[model samples]
Target chain A: MSALPEVEIRIGGIDVGVEHDALLASTPGAGACVLFTGAVRGEGGLGALEALELEHYPGMAEESIASVVAEARTRWSVGAVRVIHRVGRLLPGELIVLVGVASAHRAEAFAAAEFVMDYLKTRAPIWKKEIGSGAERWIECRERDADAAARWIGQHTPTGESA
Target chain B: MLKLRFFASIREKLGQGSLDVRAAPDVVDVASLVRHLDAGPMPGCAATLLADNSLVAINRQLASPSTSVEDGDEIAFYPPVTGG
Candidate 1:
């Protein structure tokens, strides 16, 4: 069987350079490599957000990401898909999630990366709890994200969708 | 026997992380299992796991309400994903 995409859910910092090197190394022949990282914004809800906590469904979380990466691969001419998501308490500016895709062409890489990100936003079994002074609320799924994911449904059927 | 799990706000609302549903002949599919769970031990469970509200996975793979369930299946219920 082919190798499944690299997916991780850990508590700590992610070395952006190290991940870039690994992705580039894996898909040396690819012409374009696109990497996207999501960081905790200091401002959300009300007041200065002190920290963000991510809760994931352990085994299901990894599996969901893999499923979407697999879907991305089927829809695009993709080479490598790497996803890293951090859990537990996180402060503002700390990187929370990273999605890296490598493809033979720039457009493919860009499209696949965005598709994976959009799918992940509305489907993966992960949640963000924003913590601010005397207030904490679980981040609700946004309408924009659901719409982003919806556009892909009819354009091309993403096979192996678990959810 | 079925292993059930909950995460994020669903877990918080359910007041627990996991629950075990005893195997029953009537609990044959995802829909039945969800009905059992909702009407059984943890009430309010059905509200979160409905087709439009939350996501459910059978054995670590995404599943719909009608997906079949077996004795050893691992099922999880959680809200719409908000990750990047």
Candidate 2:
């Protein structure tokens, strides 16, 4: 009753205008589209963050993101998934990344998009250095992110198998 | 000998991305190697990188501190992921 969705993955400075256009244009066959954007906060409470430098293992980062997208596709009857992560120097308030998922219904799209982000936050091999007033510090993985990923560990797959 | 590679913040702190060290006479594990590295001429940043938990990959696969290393193995050290 529904067609397979499209998926796009990129690593660059996310353009809100472009992303909005891409999602709107690509969702004609779908009724629901969900987008998640993560940005750098001015004050992380640790110190006054001047900027964040993101570094990623070139081929590995791409492969990791692609794997997350593939897993999402297998678990949900989703249409499309678009992920873009920016690398290099970024100031506070700048966009870090975006995850967009589209499906015929709201539930599938929303769940899949969240799943993609949760996986990316943990499994992806990307590092960030926070330049702040006191001193620059590399961010450590948060326990909350691990918890989010764990929630999907035992869920039944759309294909009748564990994802 | 094994080659240890560092990247991102770790590399920036150490001021060198890679190093070569002879394998220990007995079987040497990742923890020993890390201790040796930490005892090196580490600067403030280099010390800070190790202060918090770090991730290690032996030949590009996730490895624990007790992972073994043999001659010619490639090891990488990196900070916890912060990417989407």
Candidate 3:
């Protein structure tokens, strides 16, 4: 018998470091932790950016991330996973997302962290509107993100490396 | 009845977040639900129906066009996820 992987998903404006500490505290005997942060860029190809308005389907957004983290646990020896995404109005350079994974080694930690982020981009029920240069528009989804997440779909088994 | 919800640009364009409508016999999946919402001249809905980026979810689960949905289920449609 084994305990389920620890998972945390949050939607709000808060520093990712705060969530990282909480994720680490939840997993005992994990030797490696990988963390990633996504920040609102100060500029875009269209023009200078002022801020971004993030909207999300409340219940669905949380559930989607939970599913993503659960998949990561199945693919790796992940002990704990935390995903924090901020909604509402945000200025340039503000943190918009965070993903952290705790594992017994670096490979699993890195792979699980990236996997969580890739799925979050495409699977989560969230959207972003760019506000800049006297204009605003919804940011379109990127094809590269789908490609990133696709790479994980069939490769459920580890690549024979020491993961 | 099925609760249909929209978010982000779609919500702004539609001028409402949600609407409850009696599900037709064919409205048993997400694709049909989208078609049901497009029953009127909703320009914004046209994008969601035509664009490849639009995503759908039923009962808090990411769903595809063919995903089965039941009465009282929540169906949400939104533009491709941009959040990290």
lDDT of 3 by residue, A104-144 (tens): 77788899889999998988888888998899988988889
| 2 versus 3: better TM-score goes to | 3
Give per-residue lDDT, candidate 1, residue A142: 90
Assign candidate 3 its CAPRI class: high
- Name the 10 consecutive residues with the lowest summed lDDT in model 1 chain B: B42-51
lDDT tens digits by residue: candidate 1, A18-110: 777777778857777899999999999857999998998887788778888888888887777789999999999999999998766777777
Considering just the first chain, candidate 2 attains a TM-score of: 0.85
* Worst-scoring 10-residue span by lDDT in model 2 chain A: A1-10
Candidate 2 TM-score, C-alpha based: 0.74
Give per-model TM-scores.
Answer: 0.86, 0.74, 0.84
Give me the runs in candidate 2 sitting further than 4 Å from their true place: A1-12, A24-28, A157-163, B1-3, B19-52, B65-74
Stretches > 4 Å off in candidate 1: A1-5, A154-163, B38-40, B43-52
Interface RMSD of each: 1.0, 1.5, 0.9
lDDT of 3 at B72: 93
Each model's lDDT? 0.83, 0.75, 0.77
